[model samples]
Target: MSGTVGPSAAQKRNYYLIVLSMISMFVTTSTIYMVFPLFFEEYGMSGTSIGFLISVGTFAGIVSSIIAGKYSDSHGRKPILFAGVAIYAVVFFLFAFMEKSFTMFAILRFIEGFAFYMTPVAITTMVADIFPPKQRGKAMSLYTMS
Candidate 1:
């Protein structure tokens, strides 16, 4: 109860966590999204098929966001964050082994989308909990920027 109080320590920690979360988000999203265009020709995925691949991931992310947000609101942020990151790691590992099959790649991307959604929601909730109302806007903006 005697430790550092109010915005100082919390703000510093929240800033750091926000930065970490942003980096994680960017890396995860870019890794999944960027590869499609880079190797679509080699993979033989037509523009429509590539769009489907991206759409599946995005749809999964939307679903995951809804579920993760509710769970985090009820349970807490750390567990959701850990689970998301863990699943993300697993998905990336799986993606590394993707063969010529478009179906398998689509499935991997969808799962990755789900996992990626959890991290951002959890991190944003964590930031909201840590920062004051007046500062949350700035914190969220910074989180998005970085």
Candidate 2:
């Protein structure tokens, strides 16, 4: 038998899927960053309030990334990744119809941030799972560049 060993075909497929999902996630995230302030302004939210909303989401992201990374190690990556995408889709849809309640928006922002960070943390862990140790650096480099 040949001596070289690498990721199996299924692993390679999963790696590609993770890359594509991350690309889509990044696109959706950037779109939200661009559009959210304008959307909030159209509803008459003050600049400070808008900034606070963003800050709340960012803080949630920070907290959730830590929790989700550890959780993924024990619970598995795909479930958390899929849950994150689902939560993002639901929260994004909710944003369209949100009224002027700071509490409601804050809750959504926190959840959105939690959902957003879940994707990358799980995806990163998955990339680590897919490639062998010697190949991981290159795999992660390509994954990040994608």
Candidate 3:
């Protein structure tokens, strides 16, 4: 029940967590961005179509961020985080096997965008939970910087 507990200890713990979260975020974001380029040549996707696909995903992320943020603020964070990750993993696996179709890709990207925001909202909430008010800004800055 008890361990080395102090402000510095908590800060060190959170610093590591934030670093890991940032790495996760980078990988996810890179995957989302790279998917378009990786498949475009093989799938014969035009630049315009790829642009549209990315735009739709970005738009969906914006909407999902707002909705998920509000929803998580009211409800607990774990459920939303779990649901989001589940949706993301399922959709990503499906996308890997699905036939190349713009319509299907668009739908998948939309869903992915929605689920992706969950990680950010959840991690941010977790960071807030761990850090006090005065330290939260610095913690978040470190999270983003990493």
On TM-score, the leading prediction is 2
- 60 Cα displacement, candidate 3 (Å): 0.9
**Over 4 Å off in model 3, which ranges?**
1-22
Can you give the lDDT of residue 7 in candidate 1?
A: 62
Task: Put down candidate 3 lDDT per residue, 61-90, tens digits, no spaces.
Answer: 899888888888899766777788788879
Q: Order the numbered candidates by lDDT, best leading.
A: 2, 1, 3
Clash pairs, candidate 1, are none
Per-residue lDDT of 16 in model 1: 90
TM-score each candidate: 0.85, 0.88, 0.78
- Of candidates 3 and 1, the better by lDDT: 1
Cα lDDT tens digits for candidate 2, 52-122: 98899899999999999889989999988999999999998997788767798899999999999888899
Judge candidate 2 at residue 34 and give its lDDT. 93
lDDT of each: 0.81, 0.85, 0.76
lDDT of 1 by residue, 18-115 (tens): 68766976876677667757668888778899889879989999999999999998999888888988898898888777787888888888888898
**At residue 41, what lDDT does model 1 achieve?**
81
